[model samples]
Target chain A: MVPKLWNETIEEHRRAVREAVLETTAALVAEQGLRGVTMSRIAEESGIGRATLYKYFPDVETIMVAWHERQIAGHLAELSELRDRPGTPGERLEAVLERYALIQQQRHGHAGELSALMHSGDHVTHAEQHLRHFVRELLTEGVQTGEVRDDVSPEELAGYCLHALAGAASLPSRAAVRRLVAVTLAGLRPQG
Target chain B: MVPKLWNETIEEHRRAVREAVLETTAALVAEQGLRGVTMSRIAEESGIGRATLYKYFPDVETIMVAWHERQIAGHLAELSELRDRPGTPGERLEAVLERYALIQQQRHGHAGELSALMHSGDHVTHAEQHLRHFVRELLTEGVQTGEVRDDVSPEELAGYCLHALAGAASLPSRAAVRRLVAVTLAGLRPQG
Candidate 1:
C-alpha cells in the first residue's frame, strides 16, 4: 500500500509538471513570435530544469504542437459539455455555436505569427471530423423537431455552419461575433 | 505622328514585359516556393536580361505582391462578368458561386508554401470589400424577387454566403463543391 501511494503521488506530480510546461509554452508563443520560443526559455518560464524539459519535449515545435493538442481537446470537451446541456436541440446548437465563435475569437488573438502553425497540422483533420460529427448530430435532431430545414443533409449543414462561423474569429467585437452567429442560425431555419 | 507611333509601340512592349514578369514569378513560386524566386531566375525564365528584370521590379517580394494583385484583379473581373450575365439575380448568383468555388479550389492547389502570402496584404481587404458589395447587391435583387429571405439584412446574408462558400476551397472533390454551394443557396431562401 505504501509503494502504490508513492507511485500515485509521483504520477500526480508528473502531470502537474507537464501541464505547466504546456501553459508556459503557450504563454511564451503568445507573448513572442515562434522564433523566440526555445527549450531553455520554456524551462525558465515554467520553473522546470532544462534537462527535465528536454526529457518531456525535444524541440519548440513539438512543445507548441502538444500545447495545441491540449487546446483542441479542451475545446472539444467544452463543446461536448455544452451539447449535453438540457435544452432543445436547436437551442443547444445555438449555445454551442456562440461558444465556438467566442473560442475562435480568442484564438484569433494569437493570429499574427501563430495562425499558420495553428492551421498546419494533422490534428486539424481530426478536429474537423469531430466538429462536423458533433454539429451534424445536433442538426439531425433539429431536423426531426422541425426546427431546421430538411431538404439539405445534416452533413452539408454542418459544413455550412463551420465555414460561416470561421470568419467570426476575425470579427472586430463580440457584438459582431454574435451578429454573425445570428446570421448563421437564420440560415438553418426551415425554408418557406 | 511618327514619334506618337513609336511611343505607342514602346508602351505596348512595356506592358507585355510586365505581364511576362508576373507570370514567370508565379510559375517559379508554384514550382519551387517563394524562396527559389530570385531576380536572376525570373530573368532567365522570362527571357529578359537581368538589367531589364531589375528595371521592372526591385525585389522578389515586390514581384510576388504584384503578381498576387493581378490574380485578385482577374478574379474580380470574372465575378463581375458573371454578375452581369443575362439571368435572374438568383441564377447569376448561383453561377458566380460555382465559378468562385472552382477558383478557390484552384487557389488551394498553391496553398502549400504560398497560402500565407496569398492571404496577407492590403489588397485582400480591398478584394473582400468588392466581393461583399457584389454579393450584397445580388442578395438585394433576390430579396426583391421574393426568392431570398427578407428577415435577415442583405449584408448579413452576404457575409454568411461568402464565409460558407470559402470552405469549398478545401473540399475533396467537385461534387462536394456543388453540394456546399447548394447548401449556401438553400440558406438564402425565405424562412417559413
Candidate 2:
C-alpha cells in the first residue's frame, strides 16, 4: 500500500498532468490546427512521454472532448451565477448575451468553431447536454415568469441565440457582431 | 479573333472543368480534410489534367475559396427568392432560418478538420463577411419594419441565432435542433 503522503503527491501529480494535457491541446489546436494534435505531439508539447500521456488520456478524442468540456464548464458556471442574479427574465437574458458577447470578442475566431462543436446538438456528450439544459431552463424560467415573450418557444429562441453567436463570432470585428446581436434582440423583445 | 462557335465551346468547357474541380475538392476535403487538399489530388479525384486544373485555379487556397464561394452563392440565391416571398419580417426570418437549419442539418457532420483550420481570429475572408452581412441585413430589415423587436441589434440577434444553431446542431439528434429552434422562435414572438 502507498503511504498517505505519496497518495497526496500522486493525486496532485495527476491533476497537474491533466491540466498540462488541456493546455497543450489548446495551444496545439490554436497554432498547428487540429491535425497537429497527435498523441506524440501532445506528449512532446506537454514535456511528457507518450506512455505517460496515454496513462493520463487514452486517446486524442478523449482529450479533445475533455478540453471542450473544461472550456464549456467555465462558461456554464459563469452563466449559472448570472442566472441567479436579481433581474427579470429579459434582463437576465440580456446579461447572458452581453457576457457572451464580451467573452466572445476576446476569443479571436475559435469562439464560433469551439462553440459550434459544442452546441447543444446531437453530438453533445453529457456535459454539453448539461449546458443545453441549463440554457433551456433559463429561457423556460423567463417564459414562466412572463418576462419573456410568450408567443415564441424557448427552444427556438435558444437555437437562434446560439447560432447568432457562432456566426457573429466568425465575423471580422466585434462591432459587426454586436450590431447583428442588437438587431436580433430587438426582434426578440415584445413588440410595442 | 476566335470564332464565335469556339468561344461558346470554350466557355462550356470551362464550366465543366470548374464543376469537376469542385467535386474533386469536396470529395478530397470530405476524405483527407483541408490538409489533404492538393492540386494533384484534385486532378486525380476529378480525372482532369494537372495543367488544365492550373489554368483555372492558381493555387489550392484559391480553388478552395472559389469552391466555398460557389456554395455561398447557392445559399444566397435561395435567400433572394425567399426574400421576395410575401411574408412579414418575422415570418421571413423564421422561414429563412428553417431553410438554413435544413442546410445545416445536411452539413452537420461535415465540419471538422477543415473548420478547425479556419477557426482563428484572422480567418474571416471577404466572402464570409459578405454572407454575414446578408444574414444581418435580413434581421435588420425585420426589425426596421416593426415586425421584429427593436431591443436587440440585428447583428447581435444574428450572432445569437447563429450561435444557437451551431450549438444545438452539435446534438446527436437533428430533431432536437428542430425542437430547440421552434421553442426559441416561440420565445421570440410578442405576447398577447
Candidate 3:
C-alpha cells in the first residue's frame, strides 16, 4: 500500500514537471522567435535539470508542439464550459465567440510562426473537427430556439462562424474584436 | 518620326520580354520548388539570353514578386468589373463570391507556396484594402436595397464577408464552395 501511494506521488510530480517545462518553453518561444529557442534555455527557464528536461522533451520543437497541444486543449475545455453555462443559445454563442476572440487577442505576437507550427501537427485536424462539432451543436440549439437562421444547415454556419471569427486573431484591439464578434453574431440571426 | 516609332517598338519589345520572363520563372517554380530556380534556368526556359533576362529581373525572387503583382492586378481588375455589373446588389455580391471562389479553386496545388510569396509583398496590403472597399460598397448598396441588414456598419459587414469567404481558398470542391457562399449571403440578410 505504501509503495502504491509512493508511485502515485511520483506520477504527480512527473506531471508537474512536464507542465512546467511546457509553459517555460512557450514563454521562451514567445520572447525569442522559434529559431532562437534552445533546449538548455528551456531547462534553465523551467528550473529543471537538463537531463530531466531531456527526459520530458527531447528538443525545443517537441516542447513547442506539446505547448500548443496544451493551449488547444485548454481552449476546448473553456469552450465546453461556456457551452454548458446557463444562457439563451444566442447568448452562449456570443459568450463563446467573445472568449475565443480574447484568446486570439492574447496570442498577438508570433502568430504567423505559431500558426505554422500549429498546422504542422496531426493534432490540429482533430482539434479543428472537435471545434467544428462544438460550434455546430450550439448552432443547432440556436436554430431550435428560433434565434438563428434555419435555412442554412448548422454545419455550414459553424464553418462560417469559425472562418469569420478567424479575423479576430489579427484585429488591433479588444474593442475591435468585440465588434468583429458582433458582426459574426449578426450573421447568425434569422432572415427577416 | 521614324526614330520615334523605333523607340516605341523597342519599349513594346521590352515589355513583352519582361512578361515572358516572369511567366517562365513562375512556371519553373511550379514545376520545381523555389530552390531549384535560378537566373540561367529562367532565361533558358523563357527563350531569352541570360544577359537580357538579367536586365529585366535580377533574380528568381524578383521575377516571382513581379508575377505575383500581375496576378493581384488581374484579380483586382476582375473584382472591380464584377462590382460594376448591372444587377441587384445581392446578385452582384453573389457573382463576386462565385468568381472569387473559382479563382481560389484554380490556385489549388501551389497555394501554400504562392501564399507565402503573396504575403511577402507590400502590395498585398494595398490589394486587401481595395478588396475591402469593393465589398463595402456592395454592402452599402445592399443595405439601401433592403436586401441586407442595416444595423451594422457596411464596413463591419464587409469585413465579415471577406473573412467568411476567405474559407473558399481551402475548400475541396466547387459545390462545397457554392454552399459556403450561400451560407455567407444568408448571414447578410435582415434579421427576422
Candidate 4:
C-alpha cells in the first residue's frame, strides 16, 4: 500500500506533467497553426517522454480538447470570482461584463482556428449554459434591487448581454469593449 | 447581329435561367446537406443542360456563393426599404431592428451548414460593412431627432443593437425575439 505522503507526491507530479503538456501544446499551436502540431512535437517540447505523454493524452485532438476545457474553466472561474467580489449588484455585473468583454476582445484574431475546433463539443454547451446561468443570477439580483429593468425577464436580459458582448470579438480596442459593456449595461437599467 | 427585340429577349432568358439555377441550388442544399449537392445534380434539378449550367457556374461552390450573395442582397434591400419608409426616426429604427431579429431567429437551426460554407470571402465582408453602415445611419438619424442616447457614438450604439438582436437566433419564439429587440432598442433610447 502507498503511504499518504507518497500518494500526494505522485498526484502532484501527475498534475505538473499534465500542466506542462497542455501549456506546451498551446504554445506550439499558437506559434504554428493547429495543423502543425503533433503528439511527438508536444512531448518533445514539454520535456516529457512520448510514452508518458501518451498516458496523459491520447492524441493532438484530445490534448486540444482538454486544453480548451481547462481554458474555459479558468475563464469561468475568473468571472465567478468577479461576481462574488464585494460590490453593489450593479457594480458586480459591470465588473463581470467588462472582464468578459475584454476576454472576448483578446481572443479576436487568435480564436478562428481554435474556436472552429473547440466550440462544438458537449463541454462548450455546458460552459455556455453555466455562463448564461451565472449572468442570469446576477441580473436577477440587480432586478431585486431595482437596479435592472423589471420589464424584461432576467433570463432574456442575460441572453441579450451575452450576445451583445460577444461583438467584442470584433472590436478594435479595449476602450471599444468598455463602450460595448456600457451600452449593454444601459439596456439593463430601469426604464422611466 | 441579332435584332434589338431579340437581344432583349435573349437577355431576359439569361436572367431567368440564372434565377432558376440559384433558386434550385438553394432548394437542393436545404433539402439535402451541402455534401449531397453537385454541379451535375444542380444541372439536372435546374433543368438547364450541363453545358449551359457550366457556362453559368463551374461548380457547386460557385453556385452556393452566388446564391448566398443574392440572398444577402435581398435581405439588405428589405432592410433598406424599412429604413426609407415614412416614420419617426425611433419608429423606423424599431422596424429595422424587429425585422433583423426575425431574420436572425428564422436562420438559427438552418444556418449552420450554409453559413459555414458562405460566410467567408469578399462578398460577406462587403455585406457586413453595408449592414453596419445601414444601422449606423439609422442610429445617427435617431440621435439627431433626440430619440437615441447621445452618450455613446452612433457607431458604437449601432454595433450594440446589431449584436444584441443577434441573440434572437437562440430565442424560442417570435415574442421572445421581439422582447430582445425591445431590450436592444431600450439601450438606444435617450438617457435620463
* Top DockQ model: 4
Query: Which of the two candidates, 1 or 4, achieves a greater lDDT against the reference?
Result: 4
- The model with the greater DockQ, 3 or 4, is 4
Interface RMSD of each: 3.1, 6.1, 3.5, 2.8
- Order the candidate numbers by DockQ, best to worst: 4, 1, 3, 2
Q: Is candidate 2 or candidate 4 better by TM-score?
A: 4
Candidate 2 local lDDT, residue A164: 57
Going through the candidates in order, the fraction of native interface contacts each one reproduces equals 0.48, 0.45, 0.45, 0.71
The lDDT of each candidate is 0.80, 0.68, 0.78, 0.83
> How much does candidate 2 score in TM-score?
0.71
List residue ranges in candidate 4 displaced over 4 A.
A1-64, A116-124, B4-17, B28-55, B58-61, B116-123
lDDT of 3 by residue, B1-192 (tens): 579989999999999998898788778767776667899898888899998888888877777777876776788799889978899998998898778766765665553455444552223556667778888988899999998888767887787777787767667778878877877777677776
Kindly list the per-residue Cα lDDT of model 4 for residues B141-188, writing each as its tens digit.
889999999888898888888879878877999999988988888878
The sequence of per-residue lDDT tens digits that candidate 3 reaches over residues A1-192 is 579989999999999999999877777767776767898888888889999888888887777777776787789999999989999999999999889877866776664456544653333556667888999999999999999888777987887788788777667778878877877787788766
Candidate 3 versus the native: TM-score? 0.78
On residues B7-116, what C-alpha lDDT tens digit does candidate 1 reach at each position? Answer: 99999999999999998888887887676778999999999999988898998878877777677678889999999989888899899888887777677644334644
Predicted candidate 1 versus true structure: per-residue lDDT over A37-146, tens digit per residue? 88989999999999998888888877777777677678889999999999999999999999988887787644334644556332364665787899999999999999
Error of 2 at A28 (Å): 4.6
CAPRI quality level assigned to candidate 2 from its DockQ score: acceptable
Give the top-scoring candidate (TM-score): 4
lDDT of 2 by residue, B2-114 (tens): 99999999899989999989878877887766666899988888999899889999988778667766776787788777877898877887777766666556554444334
Question: What is the model-wide C-alpha lDDT for candidate 4?
Answer: 0.83
TM-score of chain B of 2: 0.83
DockQ of predicted candidate 4: 0.50
Residues A143-162, model 4: lDDT tens digits: 99989999989999999998
